[model samples]
Target chain A: MPTQILYKPLTPEQEKRRRQRNIAIALSVAALVAIFYAITLVRLGSNVFLRPD
Target chain B: MSLVSESDLGQQSDFGSAASDASPSDYVALLKPRVMSLSIFTAFAGMLMAPHPVHPMIGAIALLAIAVGAGASGALNMWYDSDIDRLMARTANRPIPAGRMARGEALAFGLVLSAFAVLTLGLAANWLAGGLLAFTIFYYVVVYTMWLKRSTPQNIVIGGAAGALPPMVGYAAAAGSLDLSSLLLFTLIFVWTPPHFWSLALVKAGDYGRAGVPMAPNVWGPDATRLQILLYSLLLAPIGALPWILGYAGPVYGAIACLGGLGMILGGWAVFSRREGDLARKTAMRNFGFSILYLFTLFAVLVVERLTTIWLGA
Candidate 1:
């Protein structure tokens, strides 16, 4: 059997802030992904099509 | 029988309950977004003025990295200076000092972002720019915040170098090497920093004294700080015109630089001469405000000149 987990309940304010933080982290990760994609495209340029199989 | 120790419980409580209240904006506040904006502007100007063209996407990414790097240093600064920050009225409301964020949280945030920023810049641009950004972060966090700020009056004087380096980093990102033009931009900000900061320090001497940070005015007395401000202003005036004299910039930029330099000199003289009461405070405040506009105007002029030259082939 799995050991019982324990956690403290967050205050309403704390819960809201935590939600905001999670959203921010999600947005930042998305932005990072977008940046990486853009940079790869820019760096590859026309050469991306010329890649040998 | 309790499985957790008292110390472990304490740690968990501090990290979990308190941390949950720190919003993303508080994290952004740790980044010192205003300072980051200035760095971004100067870095963008540097990129525009580079001898070679930069791919727009690459340049954007490089700027983003520089901005992130600047923010990282700021977070580290807030982390290290949290104790003193609580003592100063101006800085007392900062995220760390205000109890919105924990110091360890800030430190981890700074270090992680710093690593990400440096690595991203190195990959997105060239390593030279990345290296410069890394050094800048180190200089601001280690040399300026951790060491000089507490040790000597000349902290801002020497520490100014870190703040002055974004443009050079941007130029390197674009051209992959340093140039006289880039160095001149660095020099302009370098010379402009003292009067810009000292004027504010004159007003905030009490705050510095309370915090035990040896700002020039607090340590050297207001008169010496005023004189130093004037001296730096005099130096800054000519340095501002260097780009124009060197012929990289056209007459428009030269005119703005000269007029702006004159404005600085006049502002410096006002601060120097009026050293008595409310008038003194007003002058110093005026100088402090104008000095920001002075640097911004100079860089903005350069950016416009470069853009016009690129578009019109002038």
Candidate 2:
């Protein structure tokens, strides 16, 4: 069984800020993934090996 | 009372006491040395397998970038997960959640280091390598840390792309381009991610679940996760044999990779087939621990093989 640790349940305003922070984290990661994906797509132009065998 | 924005208030609340002169040990901790050691190994493999000459200084810089980039990701991960980290015993003592450092401070430090790693790698090496380094940092921070973590059970699987990027960065640094062997090397790590991660996840399921992290065992249940671990280990055996199959590495590396990857699969399978008890946990831990050694040996063999060829002037 896992232990459930309690967080100081936030005020609505605090919750909103936490949500914003989560969004910022998500966007930052998404941007990085997009960059990596873009790199893959760019390299795929020259990556004939990733092309059909 | 009227002028300060809500955003400022939140930032202030998150920010904790200032850290003292960034202790030398603390700075080293920032690099996430365990992660760096793995990144450095894969980067070295990428460099070794690539067909080109690299000035030793440039090569050193490239490794440093990968190391710093990995640390940057770790710091950012710590920053974001501090809330949950405070719950998990395994992670509770990390610099941030331990209250030794502020959450905001950790995030700022991570962002700064991430930028520095990417910028210097781009400047010191070619932009291709720099670009890859930047992508890796982002991938770990965003894709893994933010997206997949709490959002889905497949977190480690999809998020593994960042971890797989180091070999490519190393390859791009040395050769200034892509090739079959490099991508193959990348694939090996990508496939290995699930088993390597899930084993730890299995043991730490309580920690992860308590923190609201959607680890596979938490989200999908232990049995399914165990099956998934086995499936990936099977995939690992063949993919890890690529360097030899592709003729980039000699029989020595080929044999080791095959044996090592196969051993990983067997160990993982044995754990899966076992009854849930100390024996099973120990088996899984052994497989998990061995996976690290397997990867290092597989790559280290490449360096030795290359130097051997050079020494014999082959």
Candidate 3:
């Protein structure tokens, strides 16, 4: 026999908190991406646009 | 789909755990933002005092990574010490202790941030600074928090090195190496930490005692702790003036360091002599307050002098 899965519903407060955590995580990831992009550009400097044929 | 048992599900929610009630602020609290801010300030001073001018962008990111690393250590500390934290009134309201968040969550958060902060710092700045930041986090989490905090009275003395490294890391981030000047900044904070913390420990011995943490005032008697505070204060005075004596800082810093060092010695003396009832607590509190002002004033003077020279093209 296959194992049964149980589902439980979240209260309104729990849902709201979960939403907040998700949003915060999303924003933090976005900020990290921006930081990486900025560091790459600054480190590459004038060489950023250069490529050898 | 298989049939589900309500008993297996019980009261558990699909959306969250016991930490479900945690808000963003709770997570911020886990980071210990106040301590993080102090690290950032001192690191900025160290960066400014360095000979080489880092690209503004690199400096900003390096500071950010250092701040995040400091926060990660604080989070890890809270995670490991949640039990003792719950026992102490001072730390009772912290997220894990207050039941707003779970210890596992804090541990995961801390570990993830630590990796990110160290790696980003290495890529943004140099590996030397990144290595120092990694050592700081590791020393604080493993040596200070796990090994020493509960086991010894000298916890903060050895652990203070972790706190003192911010300026060294900042200097390395900018200069790509350490100097006597950077080491002096580290030493200033390192020597200052014992007296600074012991004063508060004197005031909060009861809390630390209850938590079973062997703070100086609790492990050694309060009188011994007081004497130790005075001794450290005596050492801190000259060390605080070293930047000026070594010719790295201006006379303004020398004057301020002398005055502030005098104040610190006086505060230490007050705490030392006033060993009775309300007077002792009051003196300890006063010393605690002055120590903060003392370090901040010294660093502020250094930063201002650096900026002045930079601006005047000196």
Docking category of candidate 3:
medium
* DockQ result, candidate 1: 0.38
- Once fitted onto the true fold, the runs of candidate 2 whose alpha carbons sit more than 4 angstroms away are A1-53, B1-13, B16-22
**What is the C-alpha DockQ of each candidate?**
0.38, 0.02, 0.50
| Model 3, global lDDT | 0.92
Q: Give me the candidate number with maximum lDDT.
A: 3
lDDT of 3 by residue, A15-37 (tens): 88889999999999999999999
Pairs that collide, model 2: A29-B142
Determine which window of 10 residues in candidate 1 chain B has minimal summed lDDT. B7-16
Tens-place lDDT digits, model 3, residues B1-314: 65556555543342236326788888899899999998999999899879967899999999999999999999999999999999989999998888777677889899999999999999999999999999999999999999999899999999999999999999999999999999999999999999999999998999999999999988889999999999999999999999999999999999999999999999988999999999899999999999999999999999899888877884
Q: B74, model 2: CA deviation in Å?
A: 0.9
lDDT of each: 0.91, 0.80, 0.92
| Model 2 chain B poorest 10 in a row by lDDT | B16-25
* Model 1: chain A TM-score against the true structure: 0.80
> In candidate 2, what are the lDDT values of residues B1-314, reduced to their tens digit?
33444444433355542212233344456557898889998998888777765666678777877888898899898888878889999888887767556677678878988887887677666899999898888889888998888899888999988899899999998888989988988898999889999988888889998899999999889889889999999989989888799898899988999899889889878868974888878887888899888988988898888767766764
lDDT of 3 at B215: 97
After superposition on all CA atoms, how large is the RMSD of candidate 2? 12.1
**Over 4 Å off in model 1, which ranges?**
A1-6, B3-19
Residue B232 in candidate 3, Cα distance off native in Å? 0.6
Give residue B269's lDDT in candidate 3 (0 to 100): 88
